[model samples]
Target: MGRSFTVYVAVLAATGSFLFGYDSGVMTDVIESPNFLAYFQTTQTSAIVGAINSTFSGGAVIGSLQGGLTMDRFGRKKTIQMGALICLIGAVLQSAAQNLAMILTGRILAGGAVGLMSMSVPVYQAEVAHPRSRGLIVGLAQQMIGIGFIVSTWIGYGSLHAPETSQLQWRLPLAFQVVPALVLVIGMIFLPESPRYLIEEEQYGEAMRVLRKLHFDGTNDEWIEAEFFEIRRTIEAEKSVAVQGWAPMFTVPQWRTRMLHGVAVQVFTQMTGINVIGYYQTIMYKALGFTGNRNTLVAGLYNCVGPIANFIFVVFLLDRVGRRRPMLFGTLGISLALICEAALNSQNPDGQRIGYSIGGVFFLFAVSVIFSMSFGPCSWVYMAEVMPMQIRGKGNAFAVGVGNWAVSTLWNQVSPIALGQIEWRFYFVFVAWNLCVSFPVIYFLFPETKQKTLEEIDLLFAQRIERIPDEMTQREKEEAGVSAMNVENTKLHN
Candidate 1:
């Protein structure tokens, strides 16, 4: 795999994220459509409607938690294909639903598919990408999510007018999710499975073949060999522990801390309340008094801003800004935006007309812009960066399961009810929580990983640490660690 091929694989792999983003954003407007509400026999603000939307997230939580085991057992390509198959089932069920129970089941299945992709796709990208562009490849998952967001928003907007008696308003948008999933599974068949996964299973010949295919530009044999040796040594160090399964993740202090950092970043990412917008933009606009399709369009347009911001961030800011600074700085921006938006809503001087006002709309877009540039992409990129190879799948699943799906599901379950009950006051909770927790956790716990290789990230988190030598590549240094393990094996032989 040369540069173009690596990007080719990455782009197709990122289609799963497109599905994730679409499923996440599609419901935002569809759930608010009068036709949809009438069809489902539920009100815009009804608890049943909230349950309908949140149930998808509930399914995602399950998909994410179990996704790691499935990926570990079956490999990345198969895991993603399974997710696509399930998502297709969900899309069909949702399109044909006549009652809430049917749609709810569909929502769960769709959510499960998103959950699996959320955990597996990023790990797949991280494992295959060159360290020079690893952040960029991992960041593509986030960028595609933004693309998915824009696509779903436009789809919901276009389908808003299907006859009340007709189900196409919601049905078609739900059905459209299958296209990307179908493409993803087909494309994955032609792509290679992760070489890292191959090596872990003692498939050395296959792993070498993959490394050569990927890293050999016909002139980089030395560099490829270095990468191979580094991978080998890391696995050797991992095997030295002798603890299998989940136990290895916890037995080491650094690994434990790295896992926590992944979780903490994920927690704060959700706590920033971005998904609230992803799931509820139309309702929020309605509450702000932008009535009818105008409100829905505003939500769609507002969503459009995020993908652009995420694109710029990934291309320019991601590798440049490192992780902690952007996260902390962006958290502050999120807090400010929340406070401003909350204040604007609290005034409600002219009531719902605020959605039409320039100042009011500006702040709304501002919040999205800040979150898009900072928390939206950074959280996923940072988590992928921090997790070590041995436990990357399971470790990431825990972060995504707990933060993205679990916390998001819980929020979705109660937020409609909360928004109906509390209105502007609800935003204040996110503002204060972000202010209180984000800076402290990042400042105290997280380390910078801007230009470091994945193997060097191992060095950063290693229990018996030393400075990364100036002259030696991490691959060269890892040879020493492998030597120790080789000696241990020799002793056993004697």
Candidate 2:
């Protein structure tokens, strides 16, 4: 694709990511409203509160699995369109919710659509984008998510200033989720379905048309064909050993390891206590004695840091610094930050010592910065990068369905109850998960995928390098032969 067109598709697809963030972040501030609390009658049992928060996560698990079937069958563009339409339905229900049951149902409905988009967008973007810049292209999904986080928080903060009984405070924010969903639905009508998806469905003529539109200015047939040939070879390879369902993910060692890495990266990121803070920053702020707009303002400022950090990481850091190092350091930084937060809060377990929470707030903000730098962008990016071309849609859906959505539900459901019961000590759970689980998973298991093309990553895992020194050299030699064929075809144009 031309650069502008490429970015247009990426940004439009990434609105799914944006919605995911908006939905997650919207409730954070809304839950703090007395009117909402009063209406829900959830003060005595935080599980109802937990249900309101986690139902979306719970619904997302089903949505993600549905995405796997629909994305592969209907193509990426249509699947995304379907997701947006579903989200709009959810938004309408939420905007008009009369009781906690209605709002919970709305969130669950929206979660399914968001889950579909979440699984499809990155896959669509990766296949459509040039491999050289694919890291940032796919990574943009997460960056837009950070942008969504910002937009949702600001929406919540702005709504706080509205008339107390106007109902706009919470209702409007829930309604606003439709704006992005509507935009995505409209935009997809004009865009092409993923060329890769077309090829998989045996639509070669359409695939070539898309390839020409995506990779060149319609004059560079040689360049477009070269790219398509690589895709063809990979597809052939994938087809040769393809298993029916999830069996391949666990049966083949190479596939097993990559699948585990994809699943682990996702599960560990959620386990890092992000939901505890993300879902209930206002509660934490109130616990620390910051009342009213002071809490909203601080939460806004804290969430603001995320998108900025993510932009810097995806733009300037990812392709150059590679994935593993930054993720490892980010995990360690988050672990230490959690330890600091735990220690700071322990001094005021009852939150009566709110006078000394300045350090606690700082550590909380620090965790935001570090989390954005590493896991926020990288987790989804890593998941998208590691899956195979033939099974990319279904495989990614499985990983996100079980690892990301299921565990998020598990954590989000338990958090209100856990944090209420355990208080500051709850932070220790993530501290332990990071130390004992996340750190080792990234360090020992996750392979490096910096400048390597998606195809090369497949080779790296499939054809193991027992000797580290020959790894890059051997792969490049193989890639060079393919490059020579492409050069021969394009040399005349130059």
Q: Pick the candidate with the highest TM-score.
A: 1
At residue 417, candidate 2 shows an lDDT of 76
TM-score, structure 1 vs. true: 0.91
Candidate 1 lDDT, tens digit per residue, 52-159? 878998999899988878888898888988898899999999988888888999999999999999989988888888877776788889889888988998898888
- All models, RMSD in angstroms: 5.5, 5.6
Cα-based RMSD of candidate 2: 5.6
Residue 470 error, candidate 2, Å:
31
Worst 10 residues of 2 by lDDT: 464-473
Model 1: lowest-lDDT 10 consecutive positions: 485-494
Candidate 1: list runs displaced more than 4 Å. Answer: 349-356, 464-494
lDDT of each: 0.80, 0.80
Candidate 2, which segments miss by more than 4 Å at Cα? 217-223, 349-355, 463-494
Q: Write the per-residue lDDT of candidate 2 for residues 1-494, one digit (tens) a residue.
A: 57668878888889989999899889887876666777767662288877876789888998988987888678899999999999999999998999877898999999999889888888898888766667778889988887888898999899988877768788888999999999999988999988887767756567767777776765766756656555555665667667777677778777777777787888888877776788887777766667789889989988888788888888888877777887898879998998988787778765567556777788888888888888887887788888877567777888888888898888778887776788778888889989888898789878887766666678767643222221223343243333445533543231
